[model samples]
Target chain A: MSDLQARGHEDWLDDVAVYALGAMPMQDAQRVRAHIAACEICRREYALLQPAVGALAESAEAFTPGNGPIVASPELKARIMRTVRPERPGAATVPQTDAPVRRSVAPRERPILWPVYLVAAACLAIALISSISDIMLSGQLKQSQAELAQLRSRTNALASALADRQAAISDVLAAGAKHYPVDNGEVVRSGSRLYIAMYDLAAPPRGHVYQAWTLPKGSKTMAPSLTFVPDAHGVAFVSLPAGAPETSAVAVSLEPEGGSKQPTTKPLIVVPLD
Target chain B: MTEDAVVLMERVRKRDADAFEALYDAYHRLAYGLAMRMLGDASTAEDVTQAVFVKVWSSPELFRTGNFGAWIARVTRNRALDVIRSRTVRAETDLPQALPESESVEDTAFARIDRELVRSALASLPDEQRRPIEMGFFEGVTHQEIARRTSTPLGTVKTRIRSGLRKLRAQLEMTVTT
Candidate 1:
């Protein structure tokens, strides 16, 4: 063995393992590539290791759908095609390879079944064209469906946003209307509708209704406004009778269901409406 | 070189769309399959696959005369490994499951058989050898990282990987020769 080969042979073989896996560091890879160029043994070993390293990647094929090949998306093709220029016939000259070109075979004589062959070829051309068209149309349909779904989702979002905005506007406009803040609640008078909004107002116990009452000035009997139960969130909206009562006080009291004509219990809230 | 592949590549160099399309049809699945295996996510695998093809389309000259399948696999693996390395996810033992089989036909008979052989070889590996090798190639984990993560000594990890590779090399070489 040459002195250089004797010294570097073992080390270079070790590097071959890393080289095969493409895991050799860039600096080391340069050294290894150079060594392989000079050493026939290293080159053969490196070449042999390549197929194995490649098989490591090829093994992944089994995990794919059907343990077989996957087709590229039509959109991907379209995108690639955008940047790809079709060869203008004879635009660029191809450099010849080292491999020898095989001689072209002589044309064979036509069989007696020329008509049948022609008919088969025509049928095949039609079938091939039809299949390609079908594939393109299917891809387009899927793209359209996806777009439609996205549009529908966006439309629904817009509708929800619109609803939220309208609700906010209603709240802002209600702020302008006469508002009477009662205990843990507020009475809002907008046009003929009187909205009672309560916060932290627990729902009445069983067999009870939260009754609204209007106590007119200088009146012994309290006039009933509305009756309803607050929701689980401890919030309720009740519309009182149309037309505001001047010189009166609004009140809420827990009463028996089918609300009492007059509040039979202590008022939970009372707000004066001048 | 396979005759069909040589023809397709020549046409691709000439920027022939039909030829390029034919090549894409033939190899996209295997490319995507390798990406999926490395990245462990279908959508990301798809992106990597697209990137690999785009790369090939952009630089058709990179393809050598022979070994089209091997070239595609190498490109796909490298790109997928890049994606995996960029991810914040640490390599773990729980690999992704294979997807449900699709009805698509095999692109070429040779690729199908080659894939089967590789899969068999991989499956035959012991867990110790397989795990480290996968982490190195698929997750782009360094030998040191694999050693640390698996609690194996650095030397042990290296030996296991080298030994595993030797076995694989023998199996693959036999397939090619015979």
Candidate 2:
């Protein structure tokens, strides 16, 4: 029997309830998540328990007249309406009732004229066709412009990457170049520029990236540098800002995507430059 | 006759202003109440409520399935949690990333029941059972934190929450059938 099966069904049931409530700690949650993925019994139990947890939100006492004095003011509704209907000026400024108040416009009576009706129909058709053509053309134009902008962005990124690669190569070859070996990587400093050259480093876990940090000399805290993912070969060359002259040490840690303001995990590699 | 929320949502996807207004009117109280309960401040609650509704208005597609009321409440709770996180260094809880699917007939029936009934059902639970669930649900605290606050063992707190939820589910199912 698998470890999950050995642990027994009743044992996992306790975790299913807490996991459904979203109250489990990250480590415990991960274990429960893995078990739930493998165990059909636990999955059903989780699904069964979810609605009850969801129903708990309804237990909150909403504000009503005589319930309390903490009612949501009309202004709050007005603000929401304004944001949703910005195109229609003053249309939603007034708070609405439970039912949306619709304005009904009455049709006026007029004498029937066959020729006038025919002429009007023809004019409407012509106008509609012209408007549709214009709209189609406008849409295509916008698409083209967007494509152009995207291409320009890609080119600029490529140019920047090429420049950095060239600079890194020059840094390594330049006189007075200093290198400090780290775990599967090294920190290279030439003049004021610093670069982290990593090789054979495994990809960070999903939803995570390798972030570099610099601890400036005499500073207790490490300032954030940049976040990067290695290429297909598990190789990365990242350039740090020109703060290496006064920097005491550099460190890299696996952080969530978009990076964290501070190190949230232990450093995979730390290089002391000072 | 009152329109179904799904029908109103379809109209909302087409930018039917009246339908949008009706949806807002129907669920605003729930959203505001949830935010207030979690946040404990009237002005901030109103802000959170407005943000939640505006999200529904702009991206109704984010709510793919499940009870609309339940989905909105989850959104409001998550927003309130974000506000709380901004203010303190509380350990973050992992709320579900995807929208919940309405899985069974019982889930649908429970969704249709009155909110007041759910409230009363919760109120009927013993304090030991109910308090931990509330602390975990509203406060977004971990089970460990709940244990710490109540001075109970971690295992006991988990058991009480599990027992309470099971009982709550039974009561709601009974109410729906009757």
Candidate 3:
């Protein structure tokens, strides 16, 4: 066992990697499990790695948009049928049927005014402002401007993220070097209809701020939708611009590390079409 | 097919404004919720859902096989993906670095219970184990990425994660059974 450690056992290590990736061959994995059964150290080791296996099942990066759950009602059916008929579009009506009477209508649906994100952002703005006011206040004018800049950039990224996923405008621009906007639906537009704008930061506000990029032509790879990704709630990263060859996409990450004038760092979240 | 929804749709096809309003009430939230999940954002979800119903009102024939719910889902998914594709953010990487920071603690907690318990558990793991697993899951990183990130040998990273997972599974199993 000490020899295993001394030799830095690649074979043992491979077993663990397999488990973590959830790509280990089953028989080999079983052998590893057997080894663990007989060895307390291995058991503890297995115990340690077990969490990783579990994590593999999680896809725990972020919120994936969900259908929520299934819920239906009799009145719902009755109401639906009332509204629903064999629909024929761009054609004449099938004529009115008998029993247009006793209709119970489900109200015209209004989107919930869940300003959950707005409220949360406000709270965070307050919290981070307190800590970074010096940076904000030192140049007070620039700071307020920076705040606006930051907000604008965030908003731009978020708006782009919310746009439809199949188009290639951003993806084409981002084929190499550039970051795309990310979608965040936290902001809600009111009225019966909601207008979603994909705000383009276009570029960073200042020399120090990050630059925005879009995906390049024929480079549109579908980023995970809400169904799978990290942090599906607050922000969702789509595809980043492919600024680097190692980079499949581009993004708009902040860089005190001052990544490439052209995004050396990962954007907080890749904007859609970036 | 709530009471009001039926009336609204019936009149909607008939192009009755009043009835469409009633129908909108019945399915708006459900539609939004479904769209939000599919689209992953409130605004896009709202847009997709609203567009869907408008399409519903204007042309109810959009729904095939009479499964309005599924139809709505398909439309929204296509629309949402369309929106995603058109926008700047791109790539489908499940990288840990992609998670947004805006989640409230409660949201994190709920996300755990609602999505996958194992993720929440992994989030709670000590930094050592958490880092490696995130590398693997998010980047599809081989032992190499973990080693590179952790600055340890590839073998060390692999050992830590493998053993680490065993412990995690036992913990999860214990908690679930209890």
Candidate 4:
């Protein structure tokens, strides 16, 4: 890399750490590691950096929820399956996966639809409440009630349909179905590769649009990998910003709130990375 | 892992009836356990756990693979996180109330030492650095959430967390070496 005693010492330590953590860019990382082999001070510094990274990982390995019991419903699965099934099938199939239970419940892999729905509900309520006063209510109530009765019948039919779903789900779960695990190597899986950054988003070449992107690791680079108009999840899962690794780093930038060639502001958060 | 429950997931993707039920039975307990871990309250865990699996059914395609157990775990975890996030918990903070039952004494002791040391080092950080780091890593506060709670500039919040990690590493390194 450089003569062992030659490089300036001030920036040298940061280099050692960047190397140790593998946080440095590839070429620079090679240079730092090469120097570490000969330089005792850097070597010692590298040793120190090791557990610090682990402790950070341990802390980051959640960094929340602590070492506590994850509360769960005794009959939640039945409830979920009930919600989906149209009719219960007579036959049950078996689910098999290479990984076991430990890989099953790591936190981030779960569907966010529940909370997202809750958020949507709150938003809907806000939207409805704001607009409710404008509704003309004279004879509408009576008419609405008639419709409500029909809806309830429909709901009942749906319930029966759902009940069949429940039975099928019950047959499938049957008290120990294997879970499908999405391992993002962290408690959260922000998915990888181009997801939301699809170019099909480039349509309607007209109005002022919004934008999105996969960001640089550790909030560095000040550039994004891809950009798009996100769906409700605020997901613009682009080709995982090329060199991005699974570390708690990333921030989403808002660009014209529709679409932009580059990041218009700093970012919303160190996304998917966080 | 061919529990009758596992089969439902296969059907679940293609919109099967019986397979979903079988899958539900197989991994329901673990999902509950995970909810318990994230949420702590039995009731809250229960609510979130049910919601997790239910969501699985409606949007089965979102679940990209056959790893139903892990998928459930991931889903369970996400549900628990949301429940914890939106609901303001009034916890009677019990710092290190007891040694976890499953851990051996030696492992626990070493863990405790590391935890304490980490805590001490964290405490030494400037408030700016400590807040984001603790919130992000310790409290699981997402970067957006931290910025919102603190009312700090967004970029500044990021810098503080990044710099905070650098400093935290530096200090912890010093302590162990000394």
Candidate 5:
């Protein structure tokens, strides 16, 4: 190694880590940024370690419904949808700018006629009434259309959710299905699909969730699976994302939101398939 | 699942409301959760969460490619950082850039592992190592500030951070491989 490389390993390596984390003070970080830009060894090390630092953001526990220090309210989603929905193409109304401009008649250019004024006033009254009636009908029509659209969206969502639940239920009852019972749940394997069905699960502590981990065959470390929150009825049925044939064991634990790479708490459930 | 997300994003680009909602339902927790952790207020967290998702809807094109979860997480963090900056008087320093566009095999593997795994890996670290790292990243404090809060020498803080990150990388690699 060159002298610069050797010295960097001794002097600047630690700074690279701090820099990667973006926790170095401004002046110190600037100096380190300059050095790493030139030093191949330190630069490579920074690149290697940066993802790990990025992964640190994932370490924060996420908010899960019913089991949270805080729940992300549904109103928040409504607020977001409210903001973006109007921005959708063809969703907003364009103001009419094509109405003809009327020129005022000069008293000298047009002879004053009382009967004509009276007729014009009558015409104006009829036009105003017609415009108001049209506006009221248009408003009702828009409101009805909006309600219908919302109903359609809800129906589609419900249909989709029902279909998914039905599929999971069918998989559980399929021939050759194997079931392993745990503390509050059962692991079901049907063909290549695996699922965890839990009942009467207490809500996780504030800012915590129940996360699953899979031990793939011949693997010592359990790979993290999905994080879930039981419904209001205290039930959850989650399909394992990976195939069951390759997984040897399944475990679940109460973890902070976002879950842990490893189980932080004792596994509440562990089932061995083989 | 990643492929599914890519497809969903394509739909989002097409102005599909259902597709956007699906993405939101899948990821809002991660976005809001990160915001809550950083901001420590439910109301502000909700606001930040809304802001992040709105940005996603407004500019799905900003995310050309890469891990959606990671990209969203970074966006949430950056948004929270702005709020945190507005709340404090600290000197502004540039945050680190997002993960490199062309990921190495290891980076791709790391991205494939979900947030829960990464959180578990962080949980596995010793408190001394984990605390400094958390303070630096989540709290957006500098090494000197971490040293002050944790009552360690600045040099020791830097060393601990390095040691902690290396250990974290090793743990994640093991998790990914296994």
Candidate 6:
């Protein structure tokens, strides 16, 4: 009988799932790998389950930034090429209309001419100028990406401010307005215009935005208040329905920009508005 | 695409820079997705993804000619996990966990269901089964860690994960067959 058949141990079958999911403790995982390497039956089973286990990670593609996966910095390719092919590093330039670098054997005979030295000098100068331009272009690309990120952050801040203003307005309409400066900002509820002047919170990117949610007593979902953008001074306001529950907690989270029906990321602040 | 990958791998073996670029473009998203889910940080995920490609570029001989996708994926996942292990001390959270809320949306990968199908299958799973599977798969929590955090017996957690995966596999198989 084969080793796997002789062993006839079904217990390790469950471990295959844990192992494939990459959740086994190091020692147990090592043991399982060792077993699979040696046993044909176990290897086949592990192979069959491998694709499904990996599918678990792929399923999470639904949760990525709506803009799609973040592209690695443009310079990353050139940097990788330099590391991989040190002698021919310039070969790593991003797609170009120019001809590919020519690889040729060096001439053994010495050339007797001043023009050769002049040509060599010119080539070196060209290389230096090209290097400088590449660096500057890389710098420009990074700056643009940073600016785009900042714009996305501001957009999210504006969204959260709008949400908070609506929630506060609704709260005021049901009862009377309440104004209080709490910590970083002032909370004002006057008639229908409810405002929350926020302070000291930075903006988030596309996959994340600022969210204000209200948690009422004996309620499960934290009712979404608003999504908004803060001002240059980190101040913002939002107004929502004024008929909000009494003694409720107002929380803020940096969440998916499309706005999670619930908070998917960590909350930055949680305040009880009694 | 698989045939193209094989051709690219052969070209890469011969030090063809253009082929390397093509291969990197083809797989980088999948690699980044896995890394991002594992690390929970985009910058770190980018670093890990770049490093994986760089390793392949530098040492093309280490890879066999066939099955380039599987080889790169296994390498990417292992490297991402190594980074995760090094960065943070794994704290076994003993709190009861809930399924992370995300909608069934469209996305695609080789050897996996389209995004909506995968999400639908996961959503169909019972809470008891789905919770542990999500913790172990998405959060990179160990089986023992999940058991401790959920306050379930270790054996029970393993069974739930295995059963959950089997059901998902069946669901996915139906889609592929159809």
Please list, in the order the candidates appear, how each scores on TM-score for chain B only.
0.78, 0.88, 0.43, 0.47, 0.83, 0.77
> Ranking by DockQ, best first?
2, 5, 6, 1, 4, 3
Task: Give candidate 5's fnat, 2 decimals.
Answer: 0.51
User: Distance from true position, residue A176, model 4, in Å?
Assistant: 33
lDDT of 1 by residue, B44-123 (tens): 87788788778777778766444577678777776766665456574442222111011111123233346778777776
lDDT scores for all predictions?
Answer: 0.66, 0.76, 0.44, 0.48, 0.76, 0.65
Query: lDDT by residue for model 4 over A1-274, one digit each (tens)?
Result: 4665354553566555434332333334434443443344555665554334334422222222566533234455555655775445764465556777454556666565656778989999998876775465635876899899999999999978655433332222222322111211011122332222211123323443344344455554455444445333222222233443533443445565345656666654444542
Candidate 6 per-residue C-alpha lDDT over B58-92 given as tens digits, one digit per residue, 9 for 90 to 100: 76765543345545656677777667667677643
Candidate 4 lDDT for residue B8? 57
Best by TM-score: 2
Question: Tens digit of lDDT per residue, candidate 6, span A1-274?
Answer: 5888444456567777777666787556644543443334454566555566656655665566665645566676677666655776467456666787877988789866777789899999999999999999999999999999999999999977754533433342222455454555545545434345464447667566687777766676687778876654344555544344442566777877766688876666666655
Cα lDDT of candidate 4 equals: 0.48
Give the C-alpha miss distance for residue B170 in model 5, angstroms.
Answer: 1.4
lDDT of 3 by residue, A1-274 (tens): 4986646444654564454344333333333433332233433444344333433433322344453443323343344444444455756565555866566899999877858889899999998988798666678888788899999999998866544331222222111223222342111112211111122223343444433343444555422211112221122223332333322333344443233434455555553321
- Each model's DockQ score: 0.15, 0.27, 0.10, 0.13, 0.21, 0.17
Which stretches in model 1 have alpha-carbon errors above 4 Å? A1-8, A64-74, A85-274, B88-113, B173-178
> Which ten-residue region of model 3 chain B has the weakest summed lDDT?
B98-107
DockQ of 2: 0.27
Better of 2 and 6 by lDDT: 2
**TM-score between candidate 3 and the true structure:** 0.26
TM-score (0 to 1) for chain B of model 5: 0.83
- What TM value does chain A in model 5 reach? 0.46
Badly placed stretches (over 4 Å) of model 2 are: A1-8, A63-70, A89-274, B1-3, B92-106
Candidate 2 C-alpha lDDT tens digits along A212-258? 99998889999998999876656677789846788989899999999
Q: How far off is residue A59 in model 6, in Å? A: 2.7
Model 4 reproduces what portion of true contacts?
0.16
Candidate 4 — which residues are off by over 4 angstroms? A1-274, B2-7, B89-139, B142-178
- iRMS (Å) per candidate: 14.1, 8.0, 13.8, 14.9, 8.5, 12.7
Candidate 6 CAPRI level: incorrect
Task: Give per-model TM-scores.
Answer: 0.48, 0.55, 0.26, 0.32, 0.53, 0.50
Q: Give me candidate 5's TM-score against the actual structure.
A: 0.53
lDDT of 5 by residue, A202-231 (tens): 889999999999999999999999999877
